[model samples]
Target: MNTVEWSETLLLDFPPMDEVHHTFVDLLALAQAAPDETLPQAWSAVIDHTVRHFGNEDDWMRRTRFAAADNHIMQHKVVLNVMREGLGLARAGNMAAVREMAGELAVWFAKHTQTLDAALALHMRSVQSDAPARRTNRANEHPVSAP
Candidate 1:
């Protein structure tokens, strides 16, 4: 089985948000497959992407006045802190520690998306008539529409 798999059940049903969520799961698989010596580098990339993804989600939640915004943001902060600690250990050559942390992260991510993100998506849809614009495939391209 795939170490990290994305399913429709994990999708928040918001195009841009779902795209980011999918990317995060893809990164987790990459992290899991990286060579032991290169795991830190793989984790660094995951951390960067996660930071950006969480920031984008939190900003949208706050702007849209999501009722669970504060709680969701707190969870993001906690995840980031955990990642930071894992990275530090990995940088120190603790491969086993890093692997353990990655395992925990995979489970945490699956559960969080199923609960917090699912609720966020439902709330956003209830509050807004139009869905958020889909993300462009190109990194440099500007989004055609706003959330």
Candidate 2:
């Protein structure tokens, strides 16, 4: 069972995403090493954080019109569902399932960040390059109405 940790290799060079990834890794570590009594809470925290993490990425994909947004979002949905199921198993006193899920997540997250997230990060940077201009254009076209 590999313990996930924040490392140079995990740095995506995208601060917001990197920060979220770091938090995720830390939470996963906590869950993996937690005492049996603490495992459920720790696992739940990971699930909650994952929901937000995946939601943000999914939103980014949708907003940026990423070419593979559907596939990427579907993967997130599937993984989250599995994690949620693990949570249920954990609550029912299946600590082994929770521990196994944590290990699986460590592997999945490494690949996910390196590939799908890496692509999304590149797309986000591309969109950011034009964001200021787009915002200015929108502001001009739709001036704020005074209250």
lDDT of each candidate versus the true structure: 0.84, 0.88
Look at candidate 1 and tell me the lDDT of residue 91. Answer: 95
lDDT of 1: 0.84
Residue pairs in candidate 1 whose N, alpha carbon or C atoms collide under 3 angstroms:
none
Worst 10 residues of 2 by lDDT: 138-147
Best-matching candidate per TM-score:
2
lDDT tens readout by residue for model 2, 1-147:
867988888877788899999999999999999998999999999999999999999988886789999999999999999999998998899999889889989999999999999988888877877777776778757442211
Q: Mark the regions of model 1 whose C-alpha exceeds 4 Å error after superposition.
A: 130-146
Tens digits of lDDT, candidate 1, 37-90: 899999999999999999998987887788899999999999999899989999
